[model samples]
Target: MKVAVSVLGLAAIAAAHGYHEEDQTPIEGPHNALWYNTLPGDGGTQADSVFSGISTFGRIQYHPCLTSRSVKYDIAFIGAPFDTGTSYRPGARFGPSGIRQGSRRLNLYLPLCSRRVGFSGGYNVPLKANPFNSWAKVIDCGDIPVTSYDNGYALQQIEDGHNLLLSRAPYTDADKPGPAKKDRTLPRLITLGGDHTITLPLLRSINREYGPVSVIHFDSHLDTWKPKVFGGSPSQQASINHGTYFFHAAQEGLLANDSNIHAGIRTTLSGPSDYENDGYCGFQIVEAREIDKIGTDGIIKKIRERVGTEKPVYLSIDIDTLDPAFAPATGTPETGGWTTRELRTIIRGLEGINLIAADIVEVAPAYDTNAELTTMAAADTLYEVMTLMVKKGPLSGMKEKEERLELKA
Candidate 1:
C-alpha cells in the first residue's frame, strides 16, 4: 500500500510540472524561472522593487529617481497622456503608457532589426541610434498625473506640470563650451505626448525659454485650421483643440513666423482658409508625396534650409505621420504616409541641428494590436529625437553667424 501511494504522489507531481512536447523536457525549476525584484519598504510596511531576476528598464542603473531634484538632468522623459482634443478618434490619452510598455525591454539591439544599430550608415542604408544603451541621464519622470473630466482644466494642469519641470535649475547647459559637453550637457525636455494638443503646452513652455522658437512639424495633417473651420463658435476662437492649437499658437505670437515648416502633410483642407491660416503662421508645407521626389537627403536639406543652422527649433511628431500600414494605432491615421523606415531615416538626417525641445504625440494604443507596432514606432521616434538632442552643434563648418543665431535658453 505504501509503495502504491508513493507512486501516485510522483505521478501527480510530474503532472503538475508540465514538460515541453518537442523533446519531452521538464520546465525549469521555480527558482530558475522566477523573475521580478522584490524588497521590503521603509519600516517594513511595503516591499521596494530594487532588482528583479529579469531586466527592468524602469530600474535601469543610470535612470534617476522620479523624485530626484538635486541631480541636474540633461533630459526629463515626461508623459502627457491627454487625448481630449482629438477630432476623429480619441485613444491617445493612453499613448504614454503604451509607449512605456512597448519600450519596457531596452538594450543595444534594435527591436525590429536583426543586428545592433547605432551611429552607422546614414539615411540611404539607415541605422537606429540606441541612446538608451549609453550613459544617457534619462529618467522616466512618470506621467503628467493629468486629471480627466474637464478639457480646460486638463490643459491647465499639463501646462503647469511642464512649467515646473522647466523651472528646475542645475540642468545641463548644452550650449556652453570648454568644460561642459555642449550638446550633452544642456537641459532639454522630451515629451511622450497625450496627443498633439500637448504640443501647445510644450510650445508655451519653450516659448518662455526661447521666446518663440521655430517648429519642425512632422504630421500627416496641416493642423493649422481655425477653430471655426473645424466647426465651433467664433467665441470659441480661444478654444484649444489639437487640430486648432497651432492656429491659436500663431495667433498668440508663440511661433517664429516664417521659420516654421510642416512635413508629411496629406490631410484634406477646407479650401483657401487653410492656405490663409498656414500663410498667416508663415509655415512652409512639404506634402507627403514630395518625399519620393526629395528623398531623405533632399528633405533634410529642405528642413535644414527652412529652419537654418541657427535659431531654436521645437520638433513635433504626430505618429499618424507614418502610413497606417506601419502605425494603424493612431486616432486620425491618414493613409499613404511615410513608412517607419522612411520616417526614421528622415529624422536621422536631421541630426546636428539646433534643436531646443521636442515631442512625439498621437499614439492611440487602443486600436493597436497585441504586437504594439504604433507604440514601438513612437518609442523609436523618441529615441531618434533624444539622439538629435545629443548630436547638436559646432557643425563641421560652425559659422560665426550660425553661432550667433543659435538661441540658448
Candidate 2:
C-alpha cells in the first residue's frame, strides 16, 4: 500500500510539472548578455550550433552564487591551451581540448547518486522549502585564447584574456579619476590547464587584487625549484616554468608568508639542496608518507593552522599529484602518491573555507590511451572543489559530524 501511494505521488508530481522545450537545453534560462549561450534554444547568439551542441560547453549567466555581486557567475569553465613549460613531453598544450572532450562524457549528476547535481555534487542543491527541487547554473566561458609559441608572451596573453572574461566592471573616465581601489570583486574563475605553469600568472592576478591568498597546491613535485634553464629570461621555462611556479611565486612576493601556502606534495625528484635553499622560504610540505601516518584529518588540521580560517584560499592541482597507477598520462608521473580516494578526502576536508579560485593543471592527453583515468579524475576533482565553493557557508567540522551521523544511520 505504501509503495502504491509512493508511485501515485510520483505520477501526480510528474503530471503537475510543465515541461518546456528549453528544459531540454544545456543552459535553460535568462543570463547576462556577455555569457556564452550554448543551449540549443538560445537562438544562436553566443556559440555556434556545433559548439553549443556539446554538453560540456554551456552559457554563463551573471548573478550571485558564492562571491559578491560583480559579474558574478554560476561557474566559468576555461581552457588553457599551451604546454611550453613541460620538461618532458610537449603535449600538455592539448590537455584543455582533451579534458573538455573527456568531460563531455560526464552525466550532469553526481556519480554517487543518480540525481542531477552538475558534474558530481559540486553545484546542485535543494531549496530550503523544496528538497526535491535542485538547480545549478554553469557556463563554458570558452577557452583561454592562447598561441602555440612564445610561451612568455603566451602566458601574459592567457592572463589578459582571463582577466577580460573575469572583469566585471569596466573603468570609465569617472571611475578612473581616483586610483582604482583593489577590486576584490571577480568571478570564481575555474580554469582548465595548458600546463601547471599557467597557474603562476593567474595566482599573481588573484593575489594582486585580493591581497594575501592561501594556496592548496596538489602536485607530485614541489614546483619550488628556482628556474635555472632559461637564464632569467621571461620564457615559460624561466620563472613560471612548470617545475618552479611556487618557488618564483614566493620570490615574487605573491604568497604572503611561508604559512600561507600548503604544498600537498607527494612524489619528489629533488635533492636535499632543493629544500634547504629553495625560494619557498617557510612553506609547509605534506609528504605522502606523512599523510599515511597522520591521515587526511591530521593534514587538514595542519593546513588550517598554517593557512588560518580567515584568508581566501586558492587550490591549484597538478594532475600528476596522483599516483601513476591512477593518473598515468600526465607529463610528470610519480610512483608513490595519493590515490583518487585519498585526494578526494583532502579536498572534502577543506569544505567551508574561502576558496577564491582554482585550477587543474598538467593533464597531457597525448599520453592517455583510454582517456579513462586522468581526465575523469580531473573532472571529479573539479566537481569536488566547485561544490565546496557553493556550500562555503557551512562549517567544515559540522559537515563532517553530519556525515558521521548519516553513516551511523
Best by TM-score: 1
Model 2 is weakest, by summed lDDT over 10 consecutive residues, at 112-121
State each candidate's clash count: 8, 0
Per-residue lDDT tens digits for candidate 2, residues 1-409, read 6644654554455346532223322322222353442222334222222234443522223232223324434346777787888877667777776666665434332211111111221232221111012232355665766887687788887777666655543212212211112422344578889888888888767655566566877877777776763236465445567877777777777776766544456545446666565434557777767787898888778777877655567788888878888887798788787888788777777765767678888888877767468877787677677666556532233334445667999
lDDT scores of the candidates, listed in order: 0.67, 0.61
Off by over 4 Å in 1: 1-68, 108-130, 133-136, 170-186, 234-238, 393-409
Model 1 agreement with the true structure over 236-355: per-residue lDDT tens digits: 523678888888789888898898899998887767667666788779988889988878788778888899855667899999999999999998988889999888888988876777
Per-model RMSD to reference: 11.1, 9.9
Q: Which residue window of length 10 is worst by lDDT in model 1?
A: 110-119
User: What TM-score does each of the candidates earn?
Assistant: 0.74, 0.71
Clashes of 1: 8
Error of 1 at 273 (Å): 4.8
Q: Which numbered prediction scores highest in lDDT against the true structure?
A: 1
